[model samples]
Target: MSLSPLPLGGAAPSATRTPSRSAALALVFGAFVLAGCATEPPPPPAPAIPQYTSPIPASALVGRYGLAAYHRPQDATRTETQARAQCSNPYVITDGPNGGVMMYLADDTKLTEVISKQVPGQPTYIGPAEDPAGGERDRQVISFNGTVLQLKWVDPEIAKRYGIMVYVRCP
Candidate 1:
């Protein structure tokens, strides 16, 4: 084997020359380009949760009542799609876990506990409940007295998705 001193120092130039600054730069840039083109799917959208502006108090829930009217927006946008409205049948909340409240359909034999709002001033909120048996997620209803009288969904999207409404109403 032949030995030779490198032009810059004591080492021989490698069979594979070190890439020039521009070549290295191009390789780095190319790597970024390839990364950008990678097929990694975008993260799924977060669940849309409705915010009840005014939560009806527990005192109001302990009686037989009719759903005067209600709706779920086409989407949560400020103004996008027209809402779907319905006049619901009667339901009731006569008791609860601890002094809370329990709700049930006019004819339903099972009863669900009314969870208090985790956030102060938020209407009747439910879910993210724990079931050791791991039960299904539930939808929440927010009741309030208004010109139209609303049993509004706290999270309209979640309610529709689960096919469950936390409130008790003749369905």
Candidate 2:
């Protein structure tokens, strides 16, 4: 091949020029568009647990007691005497692993940790951990006078089946 004279600029002469700047600009623009479209979504909020305070502490109720179940509100007084007679086979309440009390849920034989809670305009209740006061499985403290404690389940069906619970403290 014969040698040719050089042009004024240092660029070489070619049949087809490569559009370097435009190609790179197009690639960069595409990357930005894709990045904008593919951005990650914000994470969901965490679950909230409610907090409550109890006027009556669990320690006050932890002890051996005779238990009786009665259907009517008037029968509660009568059941207290029956519960007192049941001291031979007492229902025991003990301190829980945590700073709560250990008691049996409705229809459950196994003991579970329960927290006492007092809500405004509502009676005191004891229920499972993390549950709201007067929850379905909770038991409302109808009355507790150091000697006798009356509890009624929050669930209507359970209340009908188990009735009002009377716990008479044993000597």
For residue 98, give model 1's deviation from the true position in Å.
1.5
Off by over 4 Å in 1: 1-56, 68-89, 105-109, 120-143, 146-158, 161-171
Give the distance in Å from residue 82's predicted Cα in candidate 1 to where it truly belongs.
19
lDDT (10s digit) by residue, model 2, range 1-171 = 997876545567778966677788999999999998899878888656567777668888899999999997788778889999999999999999987899999878899999889777778898985888889989998888888888899999999998899999999
What are the models' TM-scores? 0.34, 0.73
Instruction: Flag clash pairs in model 1.
Output: 55-123, 95-102, 96-101
Q: Cα deviation in Å at residue 3, candidate 2?
A: 37
Candidate 2 regions with alpha-carbon error over 4 angstroms: 1-46
Candidate 1 per-residue lDDT over residues 79-117, each given as its tens digit:
111111222344555766655467542234777664434
| Candidate 2 residue pairs in clash (backbone atoms < 3 Å) | none
* lDDT values for all models: 0.43, 0.87
